[model samples]
Target: SGAVHFTRNNLSAYIRSNVRYLVALLVAGFDPSSGPELHYIDPFGSSVPIRYGGHGSGINFCTPIFEEFYKPTLDKRTAYNIIQKCVAEIQKRLVINLRNFDVFVIGREGITKLDPINQVSLRAQLMGNPPPRK
Candidate 1:
């Protein structure tokens, strides 16, 4: 689960096909100084905003949390923070709600597969142990 900001073109057939009724709730201000504008997409066809979005198996549970915690507008730094927190929350929910669920994050930079790390980290994070503190 993650959020993506489109640059210049908001062309993502994968997102459009999978996420029904995709809408651009907010758009970053045009900065001629900056290279490209930004847009948000929720891959599972949920909801959208300027700075936040997510998709995963526990999306129903995660969406509310994201909405509550997400800022209406966010700078690059804030966007990254929101993303990290969302990922952590999804990882948490997945561990408790299901035995196995893969998590993926995609953005302008690209997608990062979290299943392997999630499997190990979620167990420690949710299971209530510090996981060696290393």
Candidate 2:
């Protein structure tokens, strides 16, 4: 009934209400009282706190991995690794060609785009087309 619920509820509702909110969001940011927080909002309007989540065709391929490995206190590097794995699995399993992907993180400062995944990289890593430098 205070700051926490208000902020959480507002975010959930806003996400659901958006016209093209057909995608899933792995959202992380800070709340005035709660500090750093993470949530997964799906196309179906369910917003949930989670250490890991995925959506669309990727969910079917990557959720089991998250189920086995997700931890509440994920370090920054580990979180990036998990996302990469999800991308790889999705690209490998799905026929759809994903051209690019963006990774965003919301921290004390604000939302920042960390790094991006490209088609070339995905093909190299997951499709066995050719390897990128490790």
lDDT of 1 at 88: 71
Question: What residue runs in model 2 are displaced by over 4 Å at the alpha carbon?
Answer: 1-27, 40-47, 122-134
The backbone clash count of each candidate, in order, is 1, 0
lDDT of 1 by residue, 1-134 (tens): 12344321343554555544444343433444542344544433333434444334666666776687666455544544444455576656656644344444443555555433345554575676533321
lDDT of 2 at 126: 61
Name the lDDT value of residue 99 in candidate 2. Answer: 66
Q: Could you tell me the lDDT of residue 84 within candidate 1?
A: 46
1-134 in candidate 2: lDDT tens per residue?
23334545565676666544345566666877776776765555456677656557778988887887678777666776677777777777889988677877666777877567666665565665533322
Best by lDDT: 2
As a whole number from 0 to 100, the lDDT of residue 64 in candidate 2 is 83
| Candidate 1 runs further than 4 Å off | 1-51, 95-134
